[model samples]
Target chain A: MSRPAPRVVEFFSGPDDLSDQQREILRKMGERFPELTVDELPLDSDKARERGIPLAPGLVIDGVILGVGSVVSAGRIRRYLQPQQE
Target chain B: MTEAPKRIYLDHAATTPALPEVVDAMLPFLREEFANPSSIHAAGRAARQAVNLARSQVAGALGCPPEQIVFTSGGTESNVLALLGAAFAREESGGKGHIVTSAIEHPAVLGACRFLESRGHRVTHVRPNAQVCIEADAIIEAFAADTFLVSLMLVNNEVGTIQPVAEVARAARERGILTHCDGVQAVGKMPVNVESLGVDLLSFTGHKFGGPKGTGALFVREGTELRPIAAGGKQERGLRGGTENVAGIAGFGKACELAARDLEGNIDKVTRLRHRLIKLLDTASPGRLNGDPEQTVPHVANVCLVYVDALLLMLNLSQRGICISVGSACASGKLEPSYVLRAAGMSDFASFTSVRFSIGPSNTEDEVDEVVEQAAEMSALLRKVRTPEEIGQCDENCPCLWEERVA
Candidate 1:
């Protein structure tokens, strides 16, 4: 069976408050992972709160918390998304 | 796969890293030269000489006599002292009750004006042009028989727009209104001669250039009567009362000296790098440059990318190892959009989508190129997710819903 395309959702305090650095990182991740679908998770959404995501800007991959920090690079996010060998 | 390096730092306008020379100049004061400048002993005399020398250097840098320079804790304090001192002096002299300032001024001036307004002083905030430059005529028009002070910034911190301070000063002088300039961003970056500008008061901070933080100065032209804000020991000629920040002042003086020597060369270098970065971004992205390109400072560039979410873009850039800021660093921590941009007629979406890239001497052409490439890529990615409807609703067209979405 083919591997499913990685689904990633990035949560932010607000849509307009992204720093230039953060925006650049998201762009790189998009290029490196062509099959990955990136979505913006609203901070006030019940779904984001249920997942125990921190109040800071963060990213989640395939329903798993990936990273919680300002300006998370694509390489670091990919590490979290990579499938581990059994 | 190896991790990508952290994003490059391009936000020098917010605050610059202290230069190695400034650090070296401050080490002795921080460690061994721990004497009170006012003490009568040899150690005290030595400290006093250092302070005096630093003062003279700063004065020289500003093309004013050393006696005119009054050291303050930072730009905020300097701004307060300049505005309040002049306003109070005018009031004491039975002058007018009105104060005039530009809408594009740093919060330091605006806050001071607000405080004055609370105390029954009327303040008229002059709006800037679409290019973010404040007109001298607007300031003149705002002035009245009761107008005693006009506060304007030499260079706007957000958009890097240079104000017509000389003309404004000349106009204010004609009407006997004291003019104060917040030169925090302009000093050390450009040639600032108080005599030429003809302003009675000016404020500058060290960290904005390369000196230590918490150190700044205000130039009160000789014979300009002013009231003291801080009451204590007669430090800073009794205007500001506190133990002098000897080390920081020494470092600031050194920074000013170096800035004077390197101002032209640094401007040329940073301007070239900024142009190169802007050119690259223009070629690869649907980004519009904010502010007047011709009249802006060399080291700052404000760019607004359409369709891309500012927050997402910032996160992605951080992930890519490039460090840039959205709007002013002072306003970064706040969830609200930039007031400066809004005042300049930028829509909520443009203000939200805009990011400021302030370059410094430490930045390189290579870093600028890397940033531009990453920014272009990130903008493209964010744009992919934003539909045309979303883009249309980004600015003022859908303010009510947009606030709901953000809130």
Candidate 2:
């Protein structure tokens, strides 16, 4: 059986404020992990508030708050998305 | 007590609070001494005396003759007057002259040059080298036989890099080119002698040095003919024809006097505080100091955090009651990267991540300590949310990855 896809969520204070470098990071992450699903979460949204994300640039992976206030690299996303060994 | 919610300001480069002495000196001008300096009455004489005294005070601070100073609305007007006035004079003398200026100059100077260009004048914008200083050679290389004026800044407003104005001035002088310096950031924050700089014209504003806004001065050396930009009453020796900003000029004079008197001590204190803040920031987070650390002014510190957007960081700091800046106040409200940093050879991303912290004489050690603690805590907290590898191989765009990039 194939493993389930990793979930990736990028948080931003606003939609228009996304930087080109940040968009590049997300695109590269998608290329690395084919099963990875990326989502942009705006800080002003109710969903972001409910998740208790910091009011800055943030990234969450599979329900875990991985980063805030910076754009994450593809290599780091791969490391975070790797399957745990039992 | 909850410590009064800590309202520390690190944006002295934007504008300083008027000093008590400045305010006291200006009060008489605003109240009983209020009169048009041009009027022939006793009140006018008193006002003229105040303006003359202020002129002398400013001249004493700048090490120029009082007669050479022309009071104007502010730095912007002073810069425009110097650039436009000289360019027009050159044009009248049978030359549609070229002007050479730096990319890192304030908008006022740049705008004046742009306006000149729109009027059939040519302009050469010299870019800074990797070291962030506009090398004297660059200015010399940009100068053509037709170049009539060279306008460079004393201290850069964004990165705080000090240019070799004296060397550039000397080079321009040898070539018979007029020289103008926007000394807004350098006048009170550092040692500024118009004579020693050997420039034909220098401009400085009041608010940057704890004086009122709307007051500024331009130093026009003797024998440097300039056409007046504004046609009005023969005020400011017919160079800048307008009713003087009496209170603002009085305050500006007092501010200059105080700044000249205590400049060395103030520089020392602000330097120590600036270094302390930088050190604390380095320990708190992984980042790089922008600009030539040694060559830049002691009061302004620019730092580029690896993956952090400077605007976001500034907002975070503001939330904590700390005042900081991503760039110059003039460039505020725009998402574009700093043109000054770009001109200084900084990458676009690096420029986007940079923040400037400017110190002032009024800033205390305790405030510095608070700023450090807050800045460090915020930086560390922001970094912790992401993995160390998340920043990944920072290119030239990443100041965090390069040590030698700081010119």
Top-TM-score structure, candidate number? 1
Residues A28-47, model 2: lDDT tens digits:
86776676677776767776
Q: In candidate 2, which residue ranges exceed 4 Å CA deviation? A: A1-86, B1-4, B328-334, B384-400, B403-407
Cα deviation of B64, candidate 1, in Å: 0.3
Q: What is the lDDT of residue B389 in candidate 1?
A: 55
Candidate 1 — which residues are off by over 4 angstroms? A3-86, B1-7, B328-334, B391-407
List per-prediction Cα lDDT, in the order shown: 0.80, 0.80
lDDT of 1 by residue, B1-407 (tens): 87768558888888989999999999999888999998999999989999999999899999999999999989999999998887777777785499999888888899999989988899999988778888888888888888888899999998899999999999999888888999999998889999999999999999988999999999999888899987777988999988899999999999999999999999899989999988988788776778888888999998877666565566567656777777623233344667888787777677767888899988888899889888887677556544545444544532223233333
**Chain B TM-score against the true chain B, candidate 2:** 0.93
Per-candidate chain B TM: 0.93, 0.93
